[model samples]
Target chain A: MISSFQKLTIAFTVLAVFTGANSLHAQQFRPAPNAHYPNHALMPPGHVGSQMLLRGGPIPGYFQPTQVRCPQGGKIAVANEGKFVAGQPSTLNVGLLIGSPYRFKITEIPGLPGTELFPTVELLDRLHPPAGLETRFPIPIHLTAQELRMAAEGMFITRVIYLEDPTNPVVVQDDANRQRFFDVRFNEDPLRVADQLGRPMAILRMGSKQPRMDRQTGRFMFSSPPVRTIMPVKQSNVPEDQLQRAIISTPSIGRLR
Target chain B: MSKTMKTSSRSYLVLSVFLASMMGCITPGTTSSGPLEKQSFENIPRPNQPASLTVSDANSKPIHRASPAAHQQRLPAGVATQQGPATLPPQAYTGPNAGIPYPAPWTPPGILGPFPEDEYVYQGGDAYQLTNVAQDFSIDNLDEEDTIAHYHTLDGKIEIERTNRIPIYAPRFASIRRIDGLNQYRHQDHVYAVDSPLALDGTAQNIGQEQVKQHVSTQRNIGTRASSLYRENQKLRDMAHQVASTEDSQMLKPQVGDLLNTKVNIKNSQEAQLSIQQQTALAQSDEETVKEYAYDLLPYKILANNRIQTNYHYEIADGNSRLDIKKVASKQDALPGELLEFTITFKNTGDKAIGNVTIVDHLSRRLAYVEDSQNCTVESEFFVNPTGKDSAILRWEIIEPMNVGQSAQVTFKCRVR
Candidate 1:
């Protein structure tokens, strides 16, 4: 006669064998991390994928000089430090560097008073102009009163400035003094659209976040970042080509003073 | 008397059954065939053609054999024969059985025959068009043990017999007694029982009982073993003595011939040191006085001269222990740490001489100039200046002015950091 202990031992052995057999068929089929999505851009910035596209030297006239044109009766200040007077009808032209972002203060809107908007400019590319003529072809950043009002009213606005494609130019009779721009829906990416149309030059973002600068308060504020200023060329009756030749023949030509 | 009669009857029955089984084993009769054997014979397929028979008397005349023409026809068409076709007789002949060819065609047996080739021919359909595909079978419903179908039931259940029983005659004894081996010992008494046969004590429980005895024979070569051990010890002592004596001799008088002569001669050592010091001082002074300049980008000067067209391009240098140059356009991508070869070509298309031609390049901070990599077709003076870390300024001044229709090129190498 088989005792209870012997019967239990046999039962346990049989159970273990069955368990092992079941385990063989119970494998979890986990796919590889990048097997399905090989080109996934999940990695953060500065990764190898992003750095590979950052080869070659900086574009010509990088950080040389850029002129910022404001609305009429409006004034502009660099980094909200009030560089330009409140009532001055002048445009702020600072030599913004690529690979860095700069913030600016917009004040004295024609219709809206005490409405100051801080906008950030991120330069993605630069123009290749002749030496000492960097200011002549500065990146024109047009801040409309509508965008300023929206930003002042706590609405976010994003504008992408792109260099028009010479091969495929936009056929529009736009004002020579003002840049040609368009609007996109909220769900659309302005930068991507700008790249599709032409070469994306810069990205501008404006919102209603006030500065947090306070003494001994571990606070942050939009302090004016030092920039090289380029003097505008004097108005003359000289031909463009002759003027370029004159500049090239000078002894200190092409050298940034 | 009744029991004996019953026993005899049972024996008779058993003997008859055994004889019957033995007869079946000895004879190959129809009754002895198993189910499998019968089934195999019953499954044999009928032949396609009926067999034919031939009858002849023992004293019949010799039969006419087939002519040589028949034999030649059986041979391959290309094969050469000793006799020509014209000399051969007519090949018509009669088979042993009526109405049959001399060389009958062959066919495989029915059991070994395979399905016709047309049955396995692929039908036209696109296997890659997987849209609206239907799954008709499940893995769970598959019969994994179908290959061994005979061993299982219709439901695929394998029944196992775990218990086995056999008939045996009953014993007369009512109880079973355990038999203790010779290793039995009483722990409480701490002594062997007096009546035990293997007891060492000289006391016997019975007066005339015999005690178990054992006899053993052994042969040990003590003298040979001792002599061998002594010889090994003496050999070890000799080795130890030799090592000790050698060590003592070396300690008392070291061998000079085994040592290497390592004395090196000194010639103008102080002069060499002074020259090295002077070179270091000059390098230090140069480093202290070197001028730094901001980088500026400018197009090739020849772009302004319609008479001379300047072409500037760069190529990636890659190979296995050698340079394999491949041109890369400005829009193409390049990897870091790759070697780049830059070339500037200048051609004179005018009818006059171009003099004092100088070319300068401001290398980007990302590129490091390779040492001694500058090359030029014309005699020129090359100058280099470090603008910043991993950056440099290169300038070349052509010593001889280029004449009409003259072309010159300058090439250099740099590694992207």
Candidate 2:
């Protein structure tokens, strides 16, 4: 019986060898066609592999926008460059900012269409009424190149106020500063500016409403917001580049007003 | 003793099978695997034909209305989709950079196009010659709304109207000059077949004189004013039409005034000229009407010197698919302070093996120079880009040729910051 089994195995092995030899011969004997022009991989796994693997820049805080009384609202990644031609499924990641640790769910607004409705946005910690965390779904917009036009396409400013000073924990001074912030001016173009390759470019605020300008080009938004610019402020202590736009929410404004 | 030996032999056999399966039949060399069956597309619609001047004559597509007549849209709330503004936690996170978000990274998707609230707004490229000011068919507006009237011009030539602005036509038809050189030796019968643009039909649609003047002023005036885009585009249409029909066909006046300063209807309505003595509108169209076209290259042939010359006419059809850049060989990842790098791959999927072919590889100013590929005989690594995205072409002019089932790769780098 063992001898018979061995003979059967030998036969199968011979068959496999013959098949391999045949395929090899065909590959060698037959001439491959000439390579054509403009042959590209359709977003191969290797190509754009880094972007997919990282999912880094697509959204700020990586879809986890935590709202802290510490600073202004966090930024989210929410744009699409390239010509944004029709029918392509482009992605935009919006981060949610919840001030404190909390659990909440998103509820669609009563009247808005699903496509038009931005993911409901609010402090999950607060879960306030109507426009609260319950109603504010994360902003998941699916805009065609055409629908994008209807979006506000300019620069504007949004501010995040911290509760007084973190270290001193003083509500008094924060309120006063908050009162002055209301006086600041800003422009509001909603279209996010992307670098040519579609990377997000920083949006700035010109101290005054008018754009800060050298002779030819204009200044970024958020250049100023009633800060003590001349008051012994050092450059290093500042968190970000001067070109970046930023506004912090202060709790002191109530007493100041 | 014999029984024990048999049991041991069985164990040995199982072990050998396990080892064989681990390695499989793979060979050491990375030789080409899989079948040689490359899918050949038969008779793909050739996209070279510029939109017919008749496209201008075609009925204007209607604009998209977001709201129904029953419920018109009111002013939309100024809710900002500021991507960087909010950084959410990574609960169900599953990406490479799926960690905590910080100063926040700049993502391509998060980058918004033109916005009204932005302190700065910019538009470039040119409009399609046939579909001028086409809001509906714009590659930019293909998704949400679909009303468009504007067309795009082929690449290579830059036309600055009194407005001094370009519409950023699509990527396909952008051309530097009209004629793509033909195979003079092949001896084709039709003169127009060899010509990229048989006749440069100048159809200047009449935007009112006021709009023209605003363009003559500053682009700011045109951009801010209502209907300014419409007016400027109309003027351009009329200008193209006038060029197409005004000149005497028999003569190349080569002079400015040789073009008749007359109106050609957008609908191609026929009109006659009055007799020099009589106000009679003369019915005329033919060789008698001078038709000066953009330059055309007669049947000509030269060894593809391994250089890609590109004319960004920017009028590709909406149907064109995004290139598979992965097939391109040369590339760069981290750029030097101001430098950028790119690698593009292309293959000959068509039945005809391409030789002496000139390709348009779009490259912009932002990318700086590094290494280029062997496919291109000549390279332009120093091209500066005022805009972020540009395309570069690798013309198969010289060097080892390609076959029907083969591919070529190229790489380039540039400085963009």
Candidate 3:
């Protein structure tokens, strides 16, 4: 008779087999903190059957699978300390700006947000400079099913480049270029993104900046995580009927900044 | 099974948890840490959420590596890889070398190389450089067993989902060109010969109808005797003279004279008529067709018998990598150069690939030529590689490639503008 411990061990073994460190979603969409995106984006479904489908997630139904929200408004004021003062006004409430009058709660999200901070990363997500071959970090990040949906609907975070790379220009055409960026998605379970509860992150590579393990081989030497922040923007005015489906957002994201 | 002392049991458990967490061996909330440069999230909190993460021990022994290289065995735990001597430049360390299973940082398949040297890659921002795509850190000690189990939980054991196939739509077009000098010549001197029965000039000179009929009737009866002949001659001469003096007679070649200041329009009308070949060509232009319908399945689907569900998970511009099956819906907005997304569902009408799958598609020669074929069963074209997800568009230009007997589909972006 197998004991519970044995069963658990077997289950653990099975789990390891299913996880690949080099998933595009894991790296691009914050699959795991350490997982890198090896497959780029169009990876064959890791498993078969609809069981792999995740419908519900833990976020308050607002932060979707691969999306996050930082809503502003409603009004807030603090008195002398970090406490809300009832029936009294304070300086915090003055001159406040509300970006949008209304915001929709999404059950689907792409990812919460990525940071360039530390203590959460065990690796980076990047590629070599074209010498030959290089390794990237195992970015263990995965958006929940809800996040994936929101991303598909344009309700998630996207990358906007500021400084331009003459060598690599940015084109909005879907088929043009997304290989260098990390995309948020939920092909894998969010909870099991990295090892267990590992935070998601991204590494940026650009210019001649992509470090190489061996410059001769064009392998990745080092890379910086793509910097990002989430803010509110006005919703589009186009009606839903006229807009084509899947023209909304990308489930794949974030190769560079 | 407990080899260590009781006191070390907790340490062992902690070690186990740590290992599981690091490798993402298994768990519902197995998340990963970002690279050395950045943190993923900063103090994230929801109105109501699990206040704390699952507790595990951190005092466990450090897992050391005998050798990062030459292990041909398994990767070492907790040790930086040994790919180079000296410091691995700032942010270097993409992952393991080619031929080895992907160890972290290095997430790309086959080999690490620069982005395809093209405008698409160079102009895509710094993010598009092939070197820029690699992650910043490297992960190690990955066992094949781990991947298998994780996949099992997701039920991904060679069980392929409905793939978002890239349709090879190489549409061809006939060039509509213009000739430079045809319309410049405008002919203004050509004369038109305007003739009508009313314009006949011999009417006044002709004999009365009764006399003419009488002469004709008697001539037939007498069989043209000398007396009748003389009368016929006189009448014929009068008609001839009337014609010769009329305006139309001057227009005729025989009567016109060099000294006549005015000329009949007939002489120039013949030269001004349009060429027969040119008229025939214009008439045929009415029947030319400019468009054609495309076939649904250009090649074969992985399965048969089942109605294949379609998706737009794959992308074309990025060398066909990022795949998102569940979220995409049919629409023109998916991307540029894309057409329509078709979904086909098929079951094992035949045997499954079981492990590796290769779908062959012979390109329709009409639209686009084969650039190249890699892992593609057949067919290739220029500027595009026909492989797992590298099928291209501008193809349907001639016809859609759809195979009968199997269900297959793809969400494609059609070009309108």
Best by TM-score: 1
Indicate the residue-level lDDT of B12 in model 1: 91
Q: Write the per-residue lDDT of candidate 3 for residues A191-210, one digit (tens) a residue.
A: 22221211112211111111
Each candidate's B-chain TM-score, in sequence, is 0.21, 0.21, 0.14
TM-scores for the candidates: 0.27, 0.20, 0.15
> How well does candidate 1 match the true structure in TM-score terms?
0.27
TM-score ranking, best first: 1, 2, 3
Candidate 3: chain B TM-score against the reference chain B: 0.14
Tens-digit lDDT string for candidate 2 (A1-257)? 56988999999899768655655544444432533322111112122222332443333222332211111121112111211112211222323333211111111212222322111112211111111122122211111221111222322222211111111112111110011122121221111111111211111111112212343321121111110001111111222222122223322211210
Q: Tell me how each candidate scores on DockQ against the true complex.
A: 0.00, 0.02, 0.02
- Name the better of 1 and 3 by TM-score: 1
Candidate 1: tens digits of C-alpha lDDT, residues A106-179: 77776788777766666665554323344555666766666667677766666667665322333222222355
Predicted candidate 1 versus true structure: per-residue lDDT over B333-392, tens digit per residue: 122334666665555544445554554454544345688998989999898866423346
TM-score, chain A, candidate 1:
0.63
